[model samples]
Structures are given as structure tokens and as C-alpha cells.
Target chain A: MESLFTWNFASEIVLSTFRMATPLLLVALAELYSERAGLVNIGLDGIMSFGALAGFMISYLTGNPFLGILAGALGGVLVNMVYAFCTVTLCAEQTVYGMALNIFAPAISAFIYRVYFGVSSTLAQATLMKTIAIPVLKDIPFIGPLLFNQTPMVYFAYLMVPFTAVFFNRTKAGLSYKSVGEYPKAAETLGINVVRQKYVACIICGLLAGIGGAYLTTCYVNTYSDGIVAGRGFIALSAVIFGHWTGSGVLMACLLFGFCDALQLKLQIISKDTPYQLFQMIPYVCTLAALAIMGAKKAGPKAKGKPYLREER
Target chain B: MKLGGKSENIIIPLIAVILAFLIGGVIIAALGSNPVDAVGYLVQGAFGSKTNIGATLVKVTPLIFTGLCACFAYRCGVFNLGGEGQFIMGAVTAVWVTVSWGLEGPLACAAALLLGAVAGGIWGAIPGILKVFRGLNEMIVSIMLNYVATLFMGWVYTELLRDGSVPQTFPVPDASKLGRLMPGMRATWGLVIAVLIAAGIYYFLFNTSKGFQLRAVGLNATASRYQGFNVKRYMLFSFIVSGAIAGLGGAIELVGTQFRLMSGFALGFGFDGVAIALIAQLNPLATVLVAYFFAVLRTGATTMQVGSGVPTSVIDIIQALVIIFAVAGMAFVRLPGFKQRMLNRQRGKKEE
Candidate 1:
């Protein structure tokens, strides 16, 4: 028990927390945009799984992790195009399509992998993104090693944090995007193309989620496995809700969730007698608690989960 | 035109199914397997023998329960995604009783079944009450609860119930086992129970005044509230009933087939319930047929893999495609000229 409070353990927890939080950050950012644009894209888990598979497969074939990232986003676009077509264009039930895609995408990815690589084959080896430390920044105290010495995606994710803030708060396209979510009819009256805004938002959402998936495969795990995404996509969406759809708020939410995730993994190792299942449940329990506390007062998009039929108005 | 509307409802789903199979064929062909032979093997495997048919029926039994669960909540305007959790808790509680209490005979079976329903009902009611009181999104809450329930159940099995080599609980007492309808196959009295419950729910939903009020709440809560219906109460009731039905699915799968609680035994069945309900368009009776159809595809999946060397996940792709096309109102993909002509016809009718 005395050793449990050691600085060695504390630093490990802090470092792993950032690593665990990266995928959630990217995915939450994706869902943030889509939800802001009046679409409930809860199918991020499935989309992420597809992205992970495609990224891994491409990196395995080309030996280029950068190309893996690009292909991963493209994979996400292809899948979300179906979702955008159904929910945005055809005005299908958003929840139903999202749910179906959650099941469908992962199964298809797994099936393709199995067909190509056979069920008995070992995990494919691929080039993993190496840790890149920002030289001057790395010399600083506690925050330096924690934030500066990390993978390229980690730096990219942090940069996007501020980028998203500027994108949403100051940009014209972003303002129009928010308007489409708030009141599509009003936005239409104001000369904003509501459908077009939604389509772009949904596509961008997929692209970001794809990067999240690619990061999981090429940076963290370096091999594709079933369940690699493992509900991070869903957790990320919950973070979006917990943050009340703000960029900084989502960052805090993802950090909190990442802390819980990292704590669970650490506790399982340090405390052997405890039921590991209880430790495994921490992140999910946190999500439920956050939703319960924040849900009632949430100020989400007004036209969310509803189809926009221009002629009906 | 009225008759045409009803027929289109049937026609659209059929078209979606056919289109899914055709696309699936293309996928199979891309994988270098003969699509025709693969589908043939799938059909034959699902219905080749009495035993095969019985296995398919056994699969349908649980699906019916889960489908009805989704159907009930969907009709009341609730999306109860916690079928997986409710089902898991139901299986855990049912198995816990059988192992700890050591009940036997038909009376024991009744107790196990009743206890399973109650456990599931309580689990179901949690999210339902939360939605009404706390204004949380039931969909998100329910999905979270699924993980909690799954993890909790895993903890229970590891810490308490598991005393042997396997992670599952000890088998339920033979005396409490569901009676087999076929000696060699897995089909049991649960199938009859499923059918009767489906008919009962159909009667409750379409024929009874309370059911009408529930439907009214689903269709127009504001209007129902104006007419003095308790919208919140009905919504809660819908969720509880939906949970109970899904829980019963877990319980039936436990006593009727698996005879023990194992992690992931009921993994995708809950989502499969969503698919079934959607395909049936939330009709209770239609769920029976849809559940069976899904069951055939599921039960035949292994055979499809064996015969075609194509992964059985092809079924999942087909089901997803079916749901998308069936729900998406495939109206905008027509040729430009055709779409223009249709628009002109609509305008002409409006002018007339």
C-alpha cells in the first residue's frame, strides 16, 4: 500500500492516460462536429473499427504509416457515406441506421480480414509511428515529458484541440453549420444550404473518427485485432455530451475518462485480489454518471436526429 | 391508393431483401466464391433436416423475446438499447438461483422463470425511471448499462458462482429443465411460450384500450396529454415491459438451451432484436416471422462458411443493408430524367 503512492507509478499513470486519451479525443472531436450539425452519429465505434482495420491493412501492405492514416480516413468516408445518404438524404431513422452500422461495419471488417489473412494467421507486423519529442519543449519540468514527448498523433491531437475552438467559434462555415442544426428552416431562409452543411459535417466527422482509428492501430497497438477500438468510439461520444459540445469541455471530458481508464489498468496490476471485472467497469460507470449529471441541462442542437425535408416546410 | 400504400409496405421490404442478397452475391463473387452455390449451401444447412429445423426454431425462440422487447418500446417511442444488459442480468440472476438455492421439479422451473422475469423487469425499469425523472437520454443510459451489467455479471461468475474449470455456472437442475419438443434437437417448450406471448402482446397492443393509449402516447404525446392520458407513466411502462421481454429471452436461453450462464453467450442477440423489430416495422406478429428469418441466416452461417469458404459475416452485411434500404425510403437515387418526370407529375396533380 505504501508503494502504491510512488512517483514511478504516478508518472506511468500520467503518461498512459495521455496515450489512452488520444483516440477518445479525436473521436469526440468528430462526434462534436456531427452532433453540432444536427446529426446524431452514434455509430463511431463501428466506423472506428473499420478505420482501424483499413489502416492496419494498408500499412501492412505499403509499409507507410502515413498512407495508413489517409486510407483509414477514406475507409471511414466510404462507410459514413452510406450513413449520410440514409439519414441525411433519405431522412431515414438516425438511431436505427447508427445502430445497424455499429453492428455491420465491425462484422464486415472482421470478415474481410479473416478472408484475406485466414483465421489461423498471426497478427500482421507493421511500421508503428515512433515517439517524437519536441526538443525545446521536452526540457521543461513535469508538463514537458507528459505532453511534449509523445507520438506525432498526440501532438496533432493537442493542436486540433485549439484548432477546433477556432473553427467552431470564429469561422463562417462553422457558424452556418451551427445554424443548420439549430433551425434548418431558419437557416434555409437565411440562405444557408442546410442539407449541404449537414453532409459536409457528417463527412468531416467520419474523417476525424478515421484518424482516431488509424492512431489506435499504427501508433498504439501496431497490429489489427478484433475489438481494438473496444468502445472508445462510444466513450468519445459520451465525452461530447459531457462537455456540452464545446472543444475545451470535450478535452476535459476525454481527460477525465482517460484518467479513469488508466486508473483501472493500473489498479488491476497493483491490486491482485480485487475483482478485475470491477476495475474494467470504471470507464463505463463514469460515462453513465456523467450523462446523468449533465444530461438534463444539455443544450444540444434543436434539429438533431430529425431529417430535413425541404418541401415539407 | 390506400391499398397501394399497404402493399408498398410489404413490397419495399421484399425489394430491400432481394437487393441485399444481390449485393451479397457480388461480394461473394469478389471473394472468388460462387455465390449461387454458397447461398444454396446456406439454405440447405438451415432447413436440411428435422434436426436442422429444430435448431433454427431454437434460435428463433430467444430472438422472438428480444424482438418483442424492442417492438414494445419502439411502439411507445422509446429506443431501449439495453436489451443486452437486461438479458445478461436476467441470465445471471436465473443462473444464480439455480446454483445457490438448489431448486427442483416443475415448481422450481416456475420459480426460476418467474425470478428471471422479475430481475430483468427491475433492470429494465432502472433506465426507464431515469429517463422520466432525470431526463437522461434512455438510449445512452441503456447502452452504458449494458457494459455495467456485462461487467457485473462477469464479476459475479468469477468471484462467486464459478467453482470448476469453466467460467460458466453449474448446469441448472435437470428437473427444472424446459421440456424438449424434439428428442434429438434443442427445441423446447420455450418456443411455445414465445409464440403465445407474441400473440398475447399483439392482442394487448392492437385490441385493448390501454394499448391504444400507449400507441397514442407514441404517436402524439401532446395530443395524448391533452386527452388526459398519463404520457410519462405509459412511457415508463413501455420500457419495463420491453425490458422484461428481453430479460425473458436471456432466461429462456439459459434454461432452455445453454443451461448455464457464460459470458458473451447472448452477445449479439440484443442487437439482432433491434434488426428484427425494424424489419417487422414494430409489429409483434411480424417479429415472429422476422425472427425466424434471421434465425435461419444465423444458424446457417457456419454451414455457409464451411461450404463457401466465405466468412459468415456476409449475413451481417446483408442484414445491415436490408435495414438501411428498408428504412431509407430509396426514392432519390433514380435517373435525373426519371426524377424530373416524377416531380412534374406531382406538380400536375397539385395544379389539378
Candidate 2:
């Protein structure tokens, strides 16, 4: 098996990195729509937390992993619905409401978990999805099985890239959505339902982010743990910004991060260049550096934080 | 633009408090706990018994410091998440200094506080310098620093500062221990010191020329720079002070209450103070009330659990709900009605 080539190592890194980046990619794409319309979904962390809980709970109950992913996505949407209703409809401060939702997330999820599984010292693990290798691709040495083989969720993640790309670039509605993000007043003047478009965008962010959370629980960890979402959502947010709000850009950034995180883990195991925790800090620090660098590079949305009012200046 | 002097701004905050408590009561009831009994236990546990009250005050002492850390940044439109890390580093550095030197009570405390402040100041200055020199955003940098600080503290606990005696550092010598407030409560004079610090910060922030410049820079840094002030330097100094204040909070918690640093010993303490700062709407004086309220909720969660068989998670739920409502600005009434008649009359008298 010629999987030992330097390029093979690099290609293999991208392959597995895709698996790791799937959840963040999905969530970042979700955020791309809402953020474009001047809303920040800081509660994406909470949403992922709740989604992980929901996904795990549903999978444990139904014994079917697909439905679990759906439930997780729905769970994310439910929280985002609260966020959307508060910030978009009730005209609350988006940041505050979003942060509060982040707080509310673990509180609610833990409360419910305690209610259902009271006094249990440990949680029961759920069923994990098996990796399916394509028949012909399975025999192609290192490149074949490695590239073609993965769980259903992994393929779904790849599908989402082109799906979102097409949705954003090729569709008339996508242009209308971008118009709302760019200038809601102008969009409204041209007869687009600016408020509706924003609501749709926020809802989509919620749904996809939930699926992202599900991917973490079912495909990766396969069991729920305290603070299981960890800091992945923040890493994903960094990816989105690094990607410059484009689908390919987000995926590539996430792959870079996944490689950094994975390489850190692997490197710490082999060498004593730095402690594992110190190496772990690299990903977050890189996020900060990337954000600062990008801030100086180019302009993003014209209206990022300003809420558009149909009647007001 | 006048906004009816400074007194009117107080109403929205007052309303936020009343609404938070009333909703908190409902939450307890929904959890199958008697709201009255929950409040009773909270009061009794926190204040009715002298020992518990002292414990509460001791807890509040450090929280007050962290709360002020957040309060300073809000006046400048920046939210700092690195307080937790900064606070822990402050404690570690202070404890290390205390062990290195043998001094009596007040001298050791002062030395520890100063050293801790400088440690926190340096750590906090990283983001500050980045924001000033490299045009970095403080919010992202602060969040990143939080992880770094937390990991650094965790590393200290495990490697450099590990103690075999117990899970924490060795007992600070009697000379290093903060003196008690009175004979009864285990609460130390840290409360008094915290109050003094708060008053000092209040005067510095509300009255001093430096405080005014910081606030001006916070309100609009570019405009302030155009007026020929050292905007970046002031901004950098702002984080140094904020981080120092937060560091002192950690020192107080360790020296006054905990007496040794350990894992999860002060878990969520810094973030709790952040919630208090927000609920207090960046008012240093009001931070006491908000911090106390949260402390009581944390103290009372146990009793609420024992009494009604409700999971203690309900208290967390209530705290989250209160934060949600506060941040959403849901509790604020932009328009004041006849309901605030008594407050209006009191303000009317104050204006004279």
C-alpha cells in the first residue's frame, strides 16, 4: 500500500480532516446566512450543546442514528427559533439574547438529563454509525478505501458544500438573500420581504448547526459527556471568518484547523517539542491571529451588526 | 439627550432586579419547591446564621473584585472573558510570593495583592497590546486568553505548584492569612478591603481625570485620539487595571476564603461575576447586590434540592433565565410610567 508517500500523508490529512471539519463546516455555513444579515449567533455553542444532548438522547431512544441526526438538527433550530424570535422579531439586542441562549442551553439540557436519568453516576452510551466502504473504491490501495470510505454523515457533509454553494450562487432567492444582507432597506424598496429572508437565514443556521452537533456526538464521540461540545463551535466560528464567509473557504479553513489540532495530538504523542495543552492553545491563538489579519485585509458585509427597520432610517 | 439627569437611568435597573426575582420565584415554584421556603433557606443560609453570613460575605469579597473587572471594561464598550484566567494566575502568583517571603498579616497581604496585580496586568496586557499595536479585536483575544490562562493555571496545579498535602496548596501561614471581620464568622477583613477597593475604583472612574479619559476613549476612541490624547496607551492601561482588579479578586478568593488553589475550586466564579456585572449594568455599587443575589442562589440550590426533590439544576436554570432576560433588555422600560411615582418624587427631592 503506497499510503506512506509524503503526499499520501498530506492527502490523508485532508480526508480525515474533512470528517473532523464536517460539523463546524455545517454550522459555519448555517451562520454564513444569518451573519450576512447583520446577526451574530454566539449561541451556536449552546445550540451545539443542546443538539449533542438531543441527538444522543434521541439515538439512545430510537436506536436509529439517522433520526437522531434529524432530531439534533431540529433541536438546534428550536433554540435558534428562540434567538430569532427574540432578536429579529422582538427587537432585542442580538448579542445579549444570543449569549443568554448560550447560558440557557446547558442549563436546560442538564436539567432534562437529570430529570430523565436521575442519580445515575454515569450515562449509557449510544449506537455508533459504521463506516461504509465503496465496493470498487475499497480495493484501490491507500487512496481508494481512505478516500471513498466513511460514515453516511461524512458524505452528507461533502454534499452540503456544493449544495450551499449552488444555493448561494445560482439561485434567484440566494441573490435576494445576499441583497438583504447587503442592504435590507434597498431590498425592501425593491419588494423583497427583507424580514422574511433574515428569518429564513437564521432558521437555516439553527437547523444545520444542530446537524453539526449531531455529527460530533454520533460520528465522533458516540457518547455524551459533560461539556462535550467543548470549544468546537468557537473553532467553527473562526473557520467561518477565515473562510471569508464562502463555502469552500470555510471548508479549507476548517481542514487547516483540523490538521493543526490532529497534528498537535499526534506530535505530542511522538515528540516532546511542547506539552499537549500548550499545543492545544495553538488552534485558538491561530483563530485570534486569523481574525486580526482578516480584519485588515478586506471589507465584509456593509451592514454587519445594524438591525434593519422597514420604517426607520 | 439629558435623559432626566442620572436618576432616571436607575429605574430600568431597578425594574430588571424586581423582574429577575419575581421570575426566579416562579422558577422555584415550577420546580416543585416552595418559593417562600427556598428564599427562607437562602436567607438563613446566607445571613440568618452568623457563620453562614460570614461565609457568604467571604465568597462575595473576591466576586466583588471580578465583578469590578467586568464593570471597568463595560464603561469602555469591551467585554472581557479572560477574567477567569487572569484571576487564577493572580492567585497562583500571590500564593507563590507568600510562600517565598515570611511576613506578618497586612504586609504580606499588600505584597501579595500588588504582585498578583502585576501578574494579571502582564497577562491582560497581551490582548491590550495586540488591540493597540496590531489593530486586534479585544473580544476574540480575551476569549482566547481565557483558555490560555485556564490551561496555564491547570498546568501550575499539576506540575509546578502541585501539593501532596491535599488537592490544593499548603495552608497559608497564620502570618499570611487575612484577619477575620469579627470574632464569630470565618469571614475575613477581605470584605472590608473589597469595599474600599470598590470605593477607590468608583472615585477613580467617576471622579479622577484618568478615569474620565478612559471613559472618553471607551465611548469613542477615534474621536478621543482626534482630541490629541494617547488613545492606545489609555486603552492598554485600561486592560492592565481591569486585569489587575480581576486578579485581586482571585487573590482574595484564595487568601481569604479558599486559602489554597485547587482544581474547580473557583469554577464559574469569574463568569458568575460577569453575569453580576451585566445585571448591575456596569454600576460598581450595584454589583454588590447582584453578586450577593447570585451567591445566595448558589448557596440555596442545596436546600431547594433537599426540600422539594427538585434537581439543583433549577437554580442554574434560574440564573441562566435571569441572564437571558437581562441581556435581551426585556426587563427595561424605555418609557417610565406612573408606577415609578415614589422613585420620581425621591429623585425630585434629590435634585433640590
Residue B250, candidate 2: Cα error in Å is: 1.2
Task: Give the whole-model CA lDDT for all candidates, comma-separated.
Answer: 0.85, 0.74
- DockQ scores of the candidates: 0.59, 0.44
Q: Name the weakest run of 10 consecutive residues (lDDT summed) in model 2 chain B.
A: B330-339
Task: List, residue by residue over B279-332, the lDDT tens digit for candidate 1.
Answer: 887889989998999999987877889887878888888888887777764333
Task: Write candidate 2's Cα lDDT for A11-120 as tens digits.
Answer: 65657666766777777877777777767777787898888889988988988788889989999989898888767765666666666666788778888778777856
Q: Tell me how far the alpha carbon of residue A6 in candidate 1 is from the true structure, in angstroms, after superposition.
A: 2.1
- What residue runs in model 2 are displaced by over 4 Å at the alpha carbon? A1-16, A134-141, A271-275, A292-298, B1-32, B100-106, B165-168, B221-230, B330-352
Candidate 2 lDDT at B284 equals: 82
- How close to the true structure is residue A115 of candidate 1, measured as C-alpha lDDT? 81
Each candidate's fnat, listed in order, reads 0.70, 0.43
